[model samples]
Target chain A: MTPPEPVETRTTTPAAGRSAQTATLAEIAREAGVSAPTVSKVLNGRADVAPATRSRVEELLRAHGYRRRRAEASRSPLIDLVFHELESAWALEVIRGVENVARGAGLSVVLSESAGRLTPGRTWADQVAARRPHGVILVLSGLDESQRALLTSRSIPFVVMDPAGDPGVDVPSIGATNWQGGLAATRHLIELGHTRIGAITGPSRMMCSRARVDGYRAALETAGLPVDPALIATGDFHHEAGYRQGLELLRRPDRPTAVFALNDLQALGLYEAARELGLRIPEDLSVVGFDDLPVARWVGPPLTSVRQPLTEMAEAAARLVLDLGREEAPVATRVELATSLVVRSSTAPPPA
Target chain B: MTPPEPVETRTTTPAAGRSAQTATLAEIAREAGVSAPTVSKVLNGRADVAPATRSRVEELLRAHGYRRRRAEASRSPLIDLVFHELESAWALEVIRGVENVARGAGLSVVLSESAGRLTPGRTWADQVAARRPHGVILVLSGLDESQRALLTSRSIPFVVMDPAGDPGVDVPSIGATNWQGGLAATRHLIELGHTRIGAITGPSRMMCSRARVDGYRAALETAGLPVDPALIATGDFHHEAGYRQGLELLRRPDRPTAVFALNDLQALGLYEAARELGLRIPEDLSVVGFDDLPVARWVGPPLTSVRQPLTEMAEAAARLVLDLGREEAPVATRVELATSLVVRSSTAPPPA
Candidate 1:
């Protein structure tokens, strides 16, 4: 575990230190002009309560920084796993990891998709509250303020795996060393005698994506090579994007002899682009990919890629969330598993 | 929807027709020499019940063909999705389909893996009984008699998707037309003027695998070509199996010019084998696959494949199980969705 980098607010302590942690449900109910049972009903996410009353209770709970005392029996023997979208093999790896931990803990996993929404909807939060799962693990997804407050008030723990965006300083998360992976990938190509190397990047909003591109830049700078803006292409981390971007890069009169794709799918797409253009891999064009997905190995000529420990990262996130639910004291707030480069036939010395 | 197929025992009727459906928990308690509350606890999967007493109650419940009365409020807002093993992109497609229906129904999906067992463990059954999901969707997995009885006694309906084995006449299942897909794939190769063709078979015990191989034989026999047993190889529907089995077939003195690999993974494995043997796809050897996974399009030379509609079948299975839980009348006992062939660049006329 990495040393804890202090998050601004790890517990239900009042912003001004007014001992809000001591507030009781009955006290909050009185403050909200509702009965104790009504407050409890709102806490349980029952729909019978009036919206106004529920809002009042929620506001008071937040203002007081109220945290429900843990009652193990009240929580279902389940853990919740939410995803930004369930689209790729990348997601399956994470799901298997969390499922592994959940099975070992005698808990089933409740899966949900935000359907491309970065924040899971209000309905999803309500469902989580009603179910009272041991904890929630979100992959490449984040919680909005209200959603975070709701989980906090219910004492339901959550951890983010590879946050797509900045998850805020207070959020606990698990991630791979994307920057390091990118650096190693670029260095490998550089070592193979390629100077005019093109790069394809994932969406800029993602921290991991940004970090990797930055690493690429760092590698070029450290090796006294010029970084050309014209050689870089942006993609959405999908195969189609890779193909479209790869074609744009390759059709250029000054096309580089090598390219680094942000992920395995993109690399495969690049392979397709190269094939369509009558280019031979490692002979006319060199390529490197990230994620080292299973397909990377099965592709023609095989792919050289940076391996992110997706399953391990997911297992760590699951364990951290569960531990957060049980431990009175805070555990590690953020952890990054190491990423390594796997060299294969996809890369070779540039053609003379 | 497909026409209704008769299932011998679709409901809770005693073998001797002694009106077991009318047997109450109180009567079951009396028969098992346990209190009514004890029987209720057993039905709820409480851990506190004595093992001997629980077994006695379970035996009585089965002997009487007991089925619990439905109580909507008692059912959790979850649907269980159990897999024979969560090993491939195929599972992700199914998960997305079930998640789509579950979200629309305002429910979440609880996922479990039988960990390669055809039958899920006893603990999984107990957990399902305890959580009481809206329904259970078992992918390539089945329930034993006692496990089925346990779910029946708890009023939890289940549907199988692409059952690996015969899921019994009484079990509701959803599947694709695997045999037809195999026939179409083989016929396409035959039309390309290939006199000799090779076939890769998945495990024989799985009905889907058996149907596929049978379809291959049908295609060859119908085309008036002598079927060569040596050209047919056995694989386990995995990349490694395809590679190993493919090597043996390709190394023969008179190897077939074209091969139908049972699934996409195996086809990719075959691709690797061809590459290793200095063979060019569509030129040296033609290949076709089943399950048309996304990788089919991205692999070099784009694999020709049979599309199984995995997600659609999963959605249908989910909808069917939910319908079974609500409808008083029996719905379709089994349904087979259609499969089609997607010919890509992997297949071509044999060498001139």
Candidate 2:
């Protein structure tokens, strides 16, 4: 294992004229044409302030780069963990990881779901700012410009875990080696003599899903196997999508003998699809999945999957955000932990 | 569906001579021989309070049944959700349920795990008191006397979800009909012509687990079958326990034709054990499980099990706690939601 290499690029660059010196609360209030108490109320997330005054005060605070003192910023003994959605066993793994770190640090975890939205709503940001938690960790979720600015103005650091979209160069993040995981999953199938391999991709918007499919393509190209577009099916990283797409791929007269699913949920769906089609695993079809969730081992035929360290990644993300909160220096760190393939009963040589 | 019955038993009883009137803060401070500010600090869970003084003041508060005014109680727009352990998909389901209610109420959730401890530690109690959320929801976790006094002093209402222990008659709790679930699961197997049936039990320390085993025994007795103590295996409600105990049960020369696992995870473990023993599900051995988790349907031969509405139970618990916080009246509520059998592919007539 190699050490984490420091990239030349930073996560976020400060606006021009940004410096060690920052404007005071009174100065921000004067610029916004509001009283100091009104400015304080806005900062405290009190709902009494008018919307117009609050917006103006917020803008001035951002423009002046007003950050509360470290003592004032971390009043609550909390670490915030936000998720795109709380579905499946995946969220549980990440929550446990964050909880582990928070407990060690003598801090509690504040959990929230973006409720299927890619970004948390504005009210969430306001509540987070008001509570003044030590740091925030986002899983498969990102903040928009204003939301980022809001947290930045208050000096509350945040780190993303397995970013769904490219979370800008300036945002610190922790992710798994999804590309390598995809390559390993495909190569294992190739080694098992499956030239005609089908691939099921996660949501197109998620970079992790895209990386896996790209790695699958690279493996096929490197191994002198044709990358048939027809065999590739799109999925939302859900069981239903996997079953639906798996049926489509399997029904073809020239169906692939093996499939690589983006995640374990999809792989289980593929298992169901194969069962409905009267196809025996290994004998009629071999399957590989990513994110070796606990159910992977318990499934029939025991899924062969790429193991992404989700809990470790969450721990890293939490720790990184806390570190960012402590240090004055900007750290543009993006760490990708290693991923490896686990061979089990699910994968075998394709039938002749 | 029957309406929730109002039990004659109340959760917590006030001490003798309790009345509508309560001791003033100044009076309590005078009695504890501390300054008003110092007494206030203790109420706020400040670390600066001397341990002896804090304990003395806490005893007075409990004796007087001092309850903070509702106006001063709910300062934070948050709800505390404590778990016994955040280990499996089960926790995720409960989290979602609480999150749903919290979101609708415009409140965020503060999640903490007791880390396998039946009750949260003193530190957790202090933190919850300081935060002063709208209410507290304890999932399979309860508060001790002192911890209860601390919350009661701060007027922080809490409701237990599926109490791990007896939880006393005075604690408001929401739980599933565990005995009914067990009966349904075992009866399903019995109806399938399995006279010789094996049972897996969760930890006997937990009331829910004990209820399940008792229900299993009741089913056997009602069927006029001899209760064979040798056929019942004890587990800790985990997959590994299921596998270990399952092996012990299956290895017997006169092994029962069917097995009823305490939970879905253990049932999955039983599947693995049967696979290792070269026995096919339903064909060679019929199985039934409780808590129809999503994986129950996705697993091979889709488990025939009892559906415990874990999410609904969590939602109900959260709402009940919030209701308790709002009303001045003490609610002696213990709701047990219905559980039903969900028969799928895992159960069938015992093989000849």
Candidate 3:
């Protein structure tokens, strides 16, 4: 796509039949009896100027049609990183990735979340807009039409990370190959000579969850195995949810000998549930998980799971947004990174 | 203070001196021979307007200085949450607290960190200014005068958490009673019948570290015990740092019977170092920690540490910044919260 021409300095000239030209910084300075530099500094939200002078300049800027341009320039290097609030355990890794890239690029990042039941007035959109950050990185569920329109109209650039639903808008995105990772996880279980494999998935509304489910099915089908619908349980991608679902799956009349959870947190839950039921990790029920977070190593019989390149993804996202901000060109791009399977003591062949 | 008089409408009319009052929706509609309601909807960032008409209106607004107020209001609600680059195990808890409140407040937060070493053209200050956030929440340390000056000039309302040095400028702040917490921790060790207590602290440049040192000295004085300068060692507040310091203290000719660490991560390091030296906690040596983070529970013998109200502190910081953003506000405010001691298995009487 062609880059838009560089924006010219704002003008205040008026043609015939038009009212007087819109006010300029020079005009506001004249009205406030201050130097143009002082007016510019105040409008940019500089704090060093005397409070009285700052207030007077702000009043004049509001009264006139003067637009503050320098502040926009100074504030564009910062990006707002948005996520859905859950346990911070997993989110921390993602944050580490984003922070590394942003800092490396001389960019500042701010974090926010849209967790808990949705509420009006105090929505994530309101908080982010109130801050007026340069670009936004949303790790969230779907956005309604109104919310999408709100961002588009404001000309704010954004990139979505691990979205829960179809992003709907055409924007740059970065995510892992969830489907591929899921298939690899299932294949690992199959190689362990486990035919009865159960699965715990994230909220089905999320795209990554759906992809993982597809991967599971594809793996079973490829191996000429009949997929049992009863073996699949959905969770909220949380430890508690994983525990609940693990218990329910284990209680089934024909319980599977192996289980694959969509995330490490859920796998941890499954571990607790298994322990409660007098089951040993690999001896009784082999369990596998995704997202090899830090906790994976510390748990008893360390977790066998798929590890997403969280830090790399974060760095890529930060770079993508900074690139978008530096150039006036608009480009829609999606970068899908790879994942690897980490084999630990959590998985073993079914007890003979 | 008395409340200001309530105006019928918060919106102020454009002063008469401004060019033709920059034709607004109503005036534009009158000139375009269209209804004011239609013009209003179009200017309000509504996508329902036909593309042809939308472009027409945009062009007209650009020409007539018809500023689109709603356009700015509709942007994403994301905020930037900044931090220093050093990675710590306990930082997760602090981040969780920030995310929890920000999500509850309906804001999305982005995470960014300053690189450890200051480099030309790629400073955290530049990143912050470029982001143009509505406000900033800085977790910074060891900022030089130039960096501080840049932030000050931005006039962005920011709240500093665990700042390294005296900000010198007026800004909202929320800090734990580090000095008091330190005293309490050291005092606990003293009360446990340990006369010779060693201490490990973070970088001395940090205010928290300095306060903790002061507390350690005060506790010894209050107990009528002589303070030993040889017993104090400084670490970088890392597990490895703690380990190195622990080894050093253990080798001292007059090694103390007990040790107090300024933070949990440091304490964990002490645990490791002791284990390597075949010393058992509370048997051969007693140890106490600060910041009762989640990992504090998982350690072999759960850690007895000081618990600071991190979540409350984050919420208070958010409130402070929001208050600053209001139309009218007080000069500035400072808040100090308390911490408590949690008795776990890590600490006991010095060995007989």
Docking quality tier of model 3: incorrect
Q: What tens-digit string does per-residue lDDT give for candidate 1 at B180-265?
A: 98899999999999979998898887889999988888999999998999898989888998898889888888988999999998
lDDT of 3 by residue, A1-352 (tens): 0011222235433323434536666776788898877765543333358988866866665444343332243343456776666354566677777777765654556665455432122345534433445667776544555454444323355777776677754657888999999999999999999999999988877889899889999999999988999999989778787789999999888899999999887888888788778888889999888988766754556689999887788777777766655544434468889989999988999888
Tell me the deviation in Å of residue B118 in model 3.
9.1
RMSD of 3: 15.4
- Residue A316 CA displacement from its true place in model 2, Å: 0.4
Which model, 1 or 3, shows the larger DockQ? Answer: 1
Q: Which residue pairs show backbone clashes in model 2?
A: A11-A169, A11-A170, A12-A170, B11-B170
The positional error of residue A207 in candidate 1, measured at the CA in angstroms, is: 0.5
DockQ numbers for every candidate? 0.42, 0.42, 0.13
Off by over 4 Å in 1: A1-20, A328-331, B1-20, B328-331
Choose the strongest candidate by lDDT: 1
Question: Residue B129 lDDT in model 1?
Answer: 89
Q: How does each model score on lDDT? A: 0.88, 0.86, 0.68
Residue range A1-352, candidate 2, lDDT tens digits: 0001111111233544456535777777788888877777776666779999999999887776676555532257889999999989999999999999999998899999999999999999999987878999999999999999898876788999999999987889999999999999999999999999999999999999999999999999999999999999999999999999999999999999999998999999999999999999978999999999999999999999999999999998888988888864445479999999999999999897
lDDT of 2 by residue, B195-217 (tens): 99998888888989999888888
